[model samples]
Target: MSSNRDDIILNVDKLSKRFGGFAAVTGVDLKVRRGSIHALIGPNGAGKTTCFNLLTKFLQPTSGTIVFDGRDITRLPAAEIAQLGLVRSFQISAVFPRLTVLENVRVAIQRRQRGDSFDFWRSERSLHAYDLEAWERLSEVGLSDYAHVPAGELPYGRKRALEIATTLALDPQMLLLDEPMAGMAHEDVGRISALIRSLSAGRTILMVEHNLSVVAELSDRITVLARGQVLAEGSYDEVSKDPRVIDAYIGVGHG
Candidate 1:
């Protein structure tokens, strides 16, 4: 446990989730410090996504509590949680495929800024300002050149970048990424990795990733899950060296 109490940004106490007869997560406790990158890793069926769903209010936990930024938010709705500056990116791309790349991001900004719906007649000027801001965000993710193109027209890698740009437009204090590199090519992986690294400065990040190399490179701390429980929690070096972890990986064949 980190004694630096000042840095604690998110705390989970005795969190558990169940789906009728099945317990997907059990008695998991976690602490994520401000501005730190934390990785959650495990083999398939390890309950990593279940835990994330519970924390982000995509699913209700059967028991336990979640505190974010000093407030208890265990029962908050997903929208409310997002309003509190906790944002998540899905394993699959979640972008408006029919909307222009810039328009997709503009809607995200408008939501965060509490602007009116994307209406041409009611708030054209404000919407245009959001468009400019969206372009700026697109630039941040290196997607500015595609601003006017329909999002579905972009390559898969670029679509993912646009999703990140949309998330950025939300101005989150903490970001949760689930399998961000799942379907990308090696070059795309490197590009997204660099983008993640660059974005981590001054922000808290929690990611669930299957790639051990990426976890090792990006995480300040790592928590391992197995069979609906926490198996280990420590630095990458410590957890990787643990005999149990080695055995688990060997049994799962590098999942």
Candidate 2:
């Protein structure tokens, strides 16, 4: 491990997941570089989502090991991983429907700053202290102007941006994104792509994105999964030219 110490941020060895008689993941291995945008992609049911869950510790792996920041976290819970600065951004459903955009980001900041001791009735003044930081996060994702707008009221793409803003509030060292470009117009896709590139300056991002175009544009490296295992790993151009990869896409419908 020390030989590759300077590069890899996350190391997965022989990872697997099983459900009753079915195996969702089987002997998958991934090495993510520090401060790089790495993508996990495949056709539907390629165990991409299951792998995401396992890495995020939302689901326990049946076998193998996961090491993050030089520590074995194979048995760690989701919350423990979050505390380690490896955080996951949920889909749009994670947003609070009633809370304003500013408020939602503030809540995330509060969680990071105060853990669970944050009191809703703590006093408007104390909460206001977080406003500055919250607004800054919103501004980072181009949502500052919509701070007053209800999170549920924003368009689909902006909601995704808000979700990212809230994730940034935690100041995570590594971000796990599940399909950041899901359900978006071409214009919003460009915006989120730009936002992701901007955020990648100092953060490690591991994402499962179906948009090959965005993946091609944003990823520093790509890991292609097939049938619960590593099928290919390389830059987009390199993987795109592999015949087996082309056959995988052709045999299974593109996700």
Candidate 3:
């Protein structure tokens, strides 16, 4: 499909990453459209995570260019990249254990507003300005009922929701999720899947997921990678039926 330049939120060209002499990702090009859900899927060791790190600036690419919105971000640092409205949610659940669910989101908002200055020592009234917005973010992720509960005490699924809430607090234009359903229970999967869908409204999402069912259900476009290269690109039905994709998955477990 042909996409107008303005319709693309992320443009990657000839992206590659080399750790010493071993190349993990090589000469991959991708374009993520605005306000759409895109999934990156492959068997184990397909370099999905390496590509993610390169995009988020956690690792500098050995070659290629990354453009977001309209600016060149290939050389930008991780913190600067996040400041530019590109945010990442890790595969692990990251939240403050002792802090209330509301507090965790508030901290994220504070970081966005204050640029890394955390003012927990300030008086209660001073931080009240952030509470309303934090509550809104919690409500967005279906966590307002647990506002007062400690983040650590939340169930695993709810904890992931809280992570999404914190991520929303940053107000990202494009969100990169690394394995959002990695360890979720069967019942919780539906809940988180719905939450992810809701979060996609008015924003672009690029996700690296292992669950083929989720990828098929949500992705507008899917990219398949194997042995550090692009294997296929199309809708789920198109790539799932590809002979190479079938061989790759059957030879080594999808993981």
Q: Which predicted model would earn the best TM-score?
A: 3
Q: What is the TM-score of each candidate against the true structure?
A: 0.94, 0.96, 0.97
lDDT of each: 0.86, 0.90, 0.91
Q: Judged by TM-score relative to the true structure, which candidate is superior, 1 or 3?
A: 3
Worst 10 residues of 1 by lDDT: 115-124
Instruction: Between candidates 2 and 3, name the one with more favorable lDDT.
Output: 3
Error in Å for residue 203 of model 2: 0.2
Clashing pairs in 1: none
102-126: candidate 2 lDDT, tens digit per residue: 9999998998889877699899998
Off by over 4 Å in 3: 91-94
Candidate 3: C-alpha lDDT: 0.91
Q: After superposition, how far is residue 177 of candidate 2 from its true place, in Å?
A: 0.7
Cand. 2 TM to true fold: 0.96
**Candidate 1 structure quality by residue, lDDT tens digits, 165-240:** 8888888899999888888888998899888988899789999998898999999999998888888999999999
Least accurate 10 contiguous residues by lDDT in model 3: 86-95
Better of 1 and 2 by lDDT: 2
